[model samples]
Target: YDPKRTRFRNQHRGRMKGKSYRGNRICFGRYALQVLEPAWITARQIE
Candidate 1:
């Protein structure tokens, strides 16, 4: 979906340089999907 107000600074490229400490472990399900690398999820791929 398109945003209402488009800013110049908000159109910058994304970087996966840092480490995430939060949500490293599963808290709900017995089998869960964890991502080792960064990726983009399209709306069509959700189904």
Candidate 2:
């Protein structure tokens, strides 16, 4: 084991079972883009 390196635990890809009710409104910025459909957004797309 390397003490200088950080290790992350494995996680399960759980179900996204329902429509999200939280954060439906824009809290910051003058403009916000809304997602009309479900999507698999990746980290590269966000950056």
Best by TM-score: 2
lDDT of 1: 0.71
| lDDT of all predictions | 0.71, 0.71
Q: Please give, for residues 1-47, the per-residue lDDT of candidate 1 as tens digits.
A: 87777666466567765445697788887987766777666899867
Estimate, for each residue in 1-47, the C-alpha lDDT of model 2 and write its tens digit.
75655576555767665555698788988997777666667999998
The RMSD of every model to the true structure, in order and in angstroms, is: 4.2, 4.8
Off by over 4 Å in 2: 1-19
Model 2 residue 3 lDDT?
Answer: 60
Candidate 1: stretches off by over 4 Å: 1-10, 42-47
* Number of the top lDDT candidate: 2
